[model samples]
Target chain A: MRISELSERSGLPVQTIKFYIREGLLPKGVNSAATRAEYDETHLERLRLIRALREAGDLPVAAIRRVITALEDPGIGLHDLFGTAAYAIGPRVEEPGDDPAWRAARREVDALLEELGWRVTEEAPARTVLAQAFVALRRLGFTPSPAALRPYAQAAAALAEHETGQLREDTTRAQALRMLAATVVYDQVLVALHRLAQEDASARRFGAS
Target chain B: MRISELSERSGLPVQTIKFYIREGLLPKGVNSAATRAEYDETHLERLRLIRALREAGDLPVAAIRRVITALEDPGIGLHDLFGTAAYAIGPRVEEPGDDPAWRAARREVDALLEELGWRVTEEAPARTVLAQAFVALRRLGFTPSPAALRPYAQAAAALAEHETGQLREDTTRAQALRMLAATVVYDQVLVALHRLAQEDASARRFGAS
Candidate 1:
């Protein structure tokens, strides 16, 4: 197939495909003449894999080259290739269903934020955080079954949304938001603050002892 | 305060604090004498900020230095500082509370898997898919409240947990785990895959119908 056909089949652009070839991520085709050349199934498969690596994995082109090269090595096993591919995908989890229990938890969290006088971002969700954590967890050897972590996911989402809303406060909008808030790195500041509050508050009301 | 006091208060070891100073992430203290230096609240505040940038924001020392320098410029506005800090942390929002949602999502996802008669993962959470998504979302933006994301988190966790368990079936345990499951760079792959899926899936499920 021509470069356009390859792009259509692989869902990549001809320019990108050409760039990949120029960047050595893709090997040049066998010399048919000075300007034109022929490609084979190997090229198509390689192109698809490259698209997979680039689009889904967000890998740098250099890394993609190394991945494809490694996969092409006949000495490697199929398991290794797929596993690498999976790793390359990084995190592969998603929400399994739309359930009421999940919604109830969100409602409870929303209410807590309201009671605490916080701005609630209704559309905020925690799936994104799970994605980053998934990459770390996958690295840690726990594939994590959904049954084990659903509660955490839901709770986490609410927590993150509520917390960020704090950053966006407009009470002192005339002054830059940075001045009203501590100039400390936002994540650590809130995480440490929340944790300290959680520990002290929980102990005060429902002492572990 | 002495370095020891600073370390204790900030929960950072003295050596790391010293490293931060050496790396220019922290401002130098005024000299108390020819050989010693005196530190104070300004130093403490800076150290806390440093910790936040490194851990939550994952800013490299060089990048953190750049952010600080940018913010120090009197001509620069608060909005620019915020954007600079965000870039330093990596091109993503550092929203908190994402983990719990993922954990919750992982839980419910498993129950659904059992209902479907899918071989559930012992190590992976059904929310594995969501877990991956969380990482992605964080990379994209880190603001979802943990509680709000519960359902999405749990469901994705369940799905991923189920998908991940299948890896073992394809190859030797050691090989699969090492090549695909263990490599840190697998994130490189998973990130790409998730993105590809997102583009296609969103088009299929949410595009104009």
Candidate 2:
């Protein structure tokens, strides 16, 4: 197919498609003739993935490139690939200078991880992410009790079991990539759902109207 | 106390405190004399809450103002105050036209809400948020089964019950405002924890090393 056809099929502008090719986000098509290259099914699929990551997942171009690179690397396992994508797009937590509040929060996070017996790396960005939240909570004078966070951990474990279960049965790399993308992006959805559920529960118990 | 004292206590720059006062996010201190104003403990508390909402919750100034206004309203109940904050910070899901994928996704969201017997309003931003995730999933060619979403809903409900339970025992309007701020900001924490837990579970099940 021609660039125009690829653009029509992918619902992207032809100029934007060319830009992606220039940025190495999409591959250049074969030069069948002068000034004209023919694309294939792979181009269409890649374009769709790129669009989903950019628009739906809100990933920056560099992060999307890292994800794509991981997907292309046969040496990377499924778990590592997922981790790569998550690390590339996850929130960044600035180092909290040596404040007592931050120190206490870090201790609490360490305790929670030990109690859960989970195997996340010490260097995982998520450790910092959780620690930052704790610091913020303490600064606001509201520390979450261990009992309160336990249900969230249990829920996360249950969801992770389900997610990993689905990944184990994958048939092709393309399918695996799709599943990984959905998994990472869906976290945002999960948070929204939780907030909505809170509203519903609040309405049931204390809504004025 | 004066503006400098309020600034020191709140850990905010005097200029930033003045900016918040100017923006109506914080109330102005009393005019003590020329080139000076008197700030009380209430000013310090409000400043802290404003900073928490801005930095931890990532709420816009306008949204924070709305939350503050709700908190100040004598007629507003605890539930309504929470609703105001949640509605203010929830993700906005723009209509995705009439694509079959989107229509199907919207129906799925509607059905899921019904099955859960949740009482979310029709205009709740979360409904659109869930629908958008479903649409993105289908576009990526991976439709999540109801079984997969059930655990998430159950977890959300459990967390919400815990959150609302705490508010029930709150003593004063000031305390309630602080609780609402914590609840809203902690959602970010919950998400980070969930991601960290998923990584742990993944490492246990499929770690390369």
Candidate 3:
């Protein structure tokens, strides 16, 4: 297939394909003649993966590059590859500034993690994200008690267990990457669904009609 | 209190407070003289609420204005106020193009909603969000079966139920708005916790050391 054919099949512009090649996100095709090259199934597959990462996962080119490297490395186990993808997709949370509210929020987050007995690292970006939420809530004069946060944690843990149960050892690299992309993108979907569900519940409990 | 004092207490800049006043997101302080005005505790409280909506809820000024209006409307019931806030925070999802894949995804979403017996409106932005997720999954060659989405919906519904149970009828308007802001912002917190939980589950099941 030529670049034009690749563009048509992948629904990406030719310039984008060229840009990806230049950025080392995609490989240059084999030169069949002067100014013309032939692409293969691998190119098409890679283009599809790139599209999924960009559109669905919303990952930057650098993160996608890391994922590609992890996929191609024989020594990177499946679990490790999943971890890399997870890290790439998680938002970068900045260090909290020194404030009484932030300090209290950080303490609350540390306690939640300890109580949950989750074996996540101290530097996990998720820790910062949780702390930020607590800080914001406290700033608004609504400190969520440990009792309020426990159910959410249990629900999250249940979903996580289900997500991990879906993974298998025999999954191919492309499939694994696709699964990871879906996992990250579906967080947005889950939030959306949760909001709708809240509306439904609110209506049942309070709606007039 | 003066504008400078309000800014100092709220941790907002004088310019931003002025902008909010000019934009009608905040009411102007009582005119004490030709060039100066006197603010009170109400101004400070409104400024704090605006900050919470902007920083925590990530709501646009327009949405925040709607929320303020709903809060000020004495006739609006507590449930109606929550509904207004929920509608304000839901993301606007663009309609997917007319493709076979999108059509299939939309049908799947419809079926899931019907199966769950959720009472969401037809034009709910979350409907489009769920459809978009399905389309993305299908495009990536990983169509999630109803079996896969069921647990997610269940988890989401459980969280929603827990969230609603926390609301009380005697809550003040400011407290209600704070609850809504916390609810909107806490989605990020929930996703972070979910990711961490997944890591824990993966480590326990697949970790080498």
Per-model DockQ: 0.02, 0.52, 0.55
lDDT-superior candidate, 2 or 3: 3
Candidate 1, superposed: residue stretches over 4 Å from native: A1-88, A92-209, B11-16, B19-24, B30-36, B55-62, B73-75, B92-209
Ranking of models by TM-score: 3, 2, 1
lDDT of each: 0.45, 0.77, 0.79
lDDT of 1 at A165: 44
Q: What is the lDDT of residue A51 in candidate 3?
A: 79
After superposition, which runs of candidate 2 have C-alpha atoms over 4 Å from their true positions? A1-74, A94-108, A168-170, B1-8, B12-45, B56-66, B93-108, B144-148
lDDT of 2 at B77: 86
Instruction: Tell me which residue pairs clash in candidate 2.
Output: none
Total clashes in model 2, counting residue pairs 3 or more apart in sequence or in different chains: 0
Give lDDT: candidate 2, residue B187: 72
Please provide TM-scores, in order, for all candidate models, with all chains considered together: 0.30, 0.77, 0.80
Q: Which consecutive 10 residues in model 1 chain B have the weakest lDDT in total?
A: B177-186
Collision count of model 3: 0
How much is the lDDT of residue A119 in candidate 3?
A: 79
Which ten contiguous residues of candidate 3 chain B have the minimum total lDDT?
B171-180
